[model samples]
Target: MKIGVALPQMAPGYGPGTTVDWARRIDAGPFSSVSVGERVTFSNPEMVATLGACAAVTERVQVLANLFVLPQHPVAMVAQQIGTLDQLSNGRLEVAVGVGGREHDYRSLGAEFKGRHQQLDDKVAELKALLAGEPPFEGADPVGPACVQPGGPIILAGALGPKAMRRAARWADGISGFSVRGDAEEIVKVGELADQCWAEAGRTTTPRKVNGCFTALGVPDASEALHSFVARYLGFLGPKLAEMIAASARASTPEVLAEILDGAEQAGCDEFILVPAVTDLKFVDVAAEVVAARS
Candidate 1:
């Protein structure tokens, strides 16, 4: 399994520079990739632009948008940006896209929130066509610099529901697991369903699966750390954040975290990205220990 670090783009008080520094630090360390999450109206900076800066500074680390909100942007424009980034990074770009669930974010962007699943599916198809060097629109110029790879950068669809998983199998190169809620049974079920969908689509090869989780290191108490972390970073979840905070608290210890990761690997996860719950770089230190042990 490959270990990656998620750059802190939405911490409580950190700025965009913090994300850059985190990317540089992770690249200098033993990580294979660095990821940034997307949030339009939230506190986080633009994912692709932040990652573009990271791509400029790093020579070896793979750059990823853990999941870009597909409903917020046009598919053609996203394809062009991703293709350019892939060329600029020498084929090191991997894009994970999903239909964002925040109603307020959609309202702010003036994008239709209903039927976003279908929109995401259509967008992914359009992106694939564009990356394959097809023209964005009928008489437009062909989108090129043509991705460093033959087709394009790896496209992973972030799917957390059954229908979305099937859509991922149909259109994306892989399915990103964002539904694991610290339950081993649920995690296994997610992997099983993903594999089933891929197979049902007549895909013989296993689709890549990526899992992500949040962590806070150097905290004396797991529950307190989890609560504080969610209260600050996941305020968008409303009151439900408290329940999620508690669930995450159960897996806070290093040993338990390792087991959780190992379970994911056993269930067919190809990569795991760890998001540090705290703003301090110390979580990276703890994550390094976890990676060393697991790898």
Candidate 2:
């Protein structure tokens, strides 16, 4: 299985220099990809823009948008932006589009919270068509400067449940899954669901499977930082529930992290993106050493 890391863009105390430094280290490390996830009501930089910068600095690692909350932005604009990022990355881009669960983010952006499922279903098709150089359904001329990837970036669905996996069967190249609790069984179940969904859709090609988990290793106050970050990140879910989620993010030790990695690989994960909770660069070095030892 390939190993990847999340660009620490969403971690608290993140800044431009930290992000750039992270990108450079990831590029030089034994990592396969550098992924960025989006959250509108957060301390992170904008996903697409940060990815553009990452693409510029790193020539080897794949630049991935782990989840671009689709319904929050205009479809045409998203198409153009991703197409441009694809070009900027020289075909090294991978996109995982999803209707995120954050209602507050939608409200803040004036995007419709309800009916997002339908909007996402529609927009995925539109985005694909636009990337393929087809005239948009909106009767607008094709958006261009064309992607470096022939069919645009490999499109994946950021799926959290069966319904989302079903939707992925229709358009996505694969599923970008997250295991919030770092549970191997959960990741395996998700892979089974994706397989079942794809077969039900009569798809001959197996869906690509990628999973991510939050980690905080070899850092000062690692557990506290992990819990604090998770609580703040998922705070919208209510303090009690957020705490519950935070408590589950306990991969602060190399032993635990290795088990999670081994289990995920056994679970049929093709790639695992490790999301870091702390901003310390030492975490990267420690993570790389651990991963190298495993390799």
Candidate 3:
């Protein structure tokens, strides 16, 4: 299985230069992809713009929007932005869409929170239609410049349940999943269910299985830092749950992370994206050293 690194965009006080530097470092490192996640009501760097900068600086690694809350934005506009991002990355962009669980984020953006799943299903279709160069409306001109990829970039869904799995089977090229502690069994179960959904839908091909986990590395008191960051990032989920998530983050030391990597590979993860709990770029170097030794 290939290994990827999530940019430190979500780290507190992280900025544009740091985002670009992280991308550059990932390009120079042994990672296969550089990814960023979305959150409108947070202090983190904006996902789309930061990804654009990453695309501008890196030539080889894949640029993934880990989870774009599709229900929070206009469909055609997002299609245009994603198409432009794919063009900027020379067809290296991979998108993952979902209806995020945060009602606060939707409220902050003035987007409706209810019926988001249905809205996401509609928006996904609309995004594909727009990317395909179909007119945005009955009598409107098509959006441009067309994607560098013939059919646009591959689309993945952050789907974890049966209903979401069924929807993904219909349109998504894959599913991007997560386990806070790098639990191989949990990830494998999710992958099997996604495959089952595809088979039930009569699809001959199986969905790509991508997994993610949180960690803290190369910093003093790494575990503490990891827990603190997780607590803050998921504070909206309530203190008890946030603390629980913080407590469950995988250890980022080489020995522990190597075990996690082996477990993910054995569990059928085609790509494993490691999300750092701390903002420091040293985490990348530490992760690289571990991954290189394993490779």
Q: Point to the candidate with the largest TM-score.
A: 3
Question: Tens-digit lDDT track for model 3 on 58-107?
Answer: 99999998988999998888988888899999999999999999998999
lDDT of each: 0.77, 0.89, 0.89
Candidate 1 stretches greater than 4 Å from native: 179-181, 219-223, 231-233, 240-247
Q: Please give, for residues 1-295, the per-residue lDDT of candidate 2 as tens digits.
A: 9999998776777875987899999999999999999988877888888888899999999999988899999877888889888888889999999999999899999999999988999988888888889877567688876898886888889886888789889888899999877799999999999999999999999999999898988688888888888888888899999999998997888888999999999999999999999888998998998899997
User: Which residue pairs show backbone clashes in model 3?
Assistant: none
Ranked by lDDT from best down, the candidates are: 3, 2, 1
Off by over 4 Å in 2: 137-140
- Which residue pairs clash in candidate 2? none
Candidate 1 residues 52-124, lDDT tens each?
Answer: 8888888888998788889778777788788788877888999899987788888887889999998888888
Higher-lDDT candidate of 1 and 2: 2
TM-score of each: 0.91, 0.97, 0.98
The clash count for each model shown is 0, 0, 0
